[model samples]
Target: MALLLTFGSYSALDGGSRPLEGNALDGAVHEAGFDHARVGEAWWVLLPVVRNRSGADVEVLDVRVLDLPAGLRAERYAAFDAEETGAPFLMVRDGGPEFPSGRYADRSGRPVRLEPGEVSRVYPAVKVRVTGEVLGEPSACRFTYARGADRFTQVLPCGFTLRLAA
Candidate 1:
């Protein structure tokens, strides 16, 4: 059985200028029945699902992750196969504020636009690595998606808790 991470209902803003309009996009971490304290290694993986329910083509800026804890590590993966399998993932980008566009933009360095019924995935892998002091515990991580001046925010459930390896 496949886990449904986000079931984003589509809407247009400013007479169809933006793809996702004012909270049309929603997100949640789909990992079920997993606890942190018993786990060993962990990764905060982010995957983008762009659904174009509108009749016309709409281009959307890639979603952004913000306010991450200092100790946790991050990485990104891009679509390899033309088919949106959401698989064969590879590390392509890193985390931080400077590269908000790195995770979601297309080859043209612009927001990825989709036609009707098209879906695309933007993957970012955040690994929890403890050197000396552990991350303590995983908390709710906040991420915001922006298109021009408008902004949308969502919280993904942290899959595993962070602690010292014993």
Candidate 2:
């Protein structure tokens, strides 16, 4: 039997002229795991794998983090095929152990292609520096993609939480 890992749910956030309300993503929670990041140091956290369940091939246009609390900044670093990479998904610095060989691709310059049933794991490098002890608020990510002539957006909670330490 094939193993399936469904860490987070996705919802269509398309077609709206008005800005999203403040509480739009309140219910979505990141349940995968947690980590402690030292203040002033950057860390890379693996986000939930994004699978192309759409019937057609989709081009992932962009990925952005939403609702991040103060003192934390997250940016998309790179993406790799989920099937080719194994976990311990936290990276302490650039070119860490989690970097995949030929399977790595940057999603910033060109859109990452995903055929139906293929999954891409996203890594967002984040930096946190705060006087607070812990951060418990959940942050979500918005993924924009184009399938054929149509463009779509989906939001899903990130997979891990970072507790800040000095």
Give me the candidate number with maximum TM-score.
2
Candidate 2 C-alpha lDDT tens digits along 11-102: 33346432221111112232543355555544555544566665555566555666666655553345544444554354333344544333
Candidate 2 collision pairs = none
Candidate 1 has its poorest 10 consecutive residues by lDDT at: 1-10
Assess candidate 1 and give its lDDT. Answer: 0.38
State residue 50's C-alpha deviation in candidate 1, in Å. Answer: 4.4
Instruction: Report the number of backbone clashes for model 1.
Output: 1
Model 2 segments beyond 4 Å from truth?
1-36, 80-107, 121-134
The total of clashing pairs for model 2 equals 0
Task: In candidate 1, list every pair of residues with a backbone clash.
Answer: 36-161
Q: How displaced is residue 122 in candidate 1, in Å?
A: 4.4
Candidate 2's C-alpha lDDT? Answer: 0.46
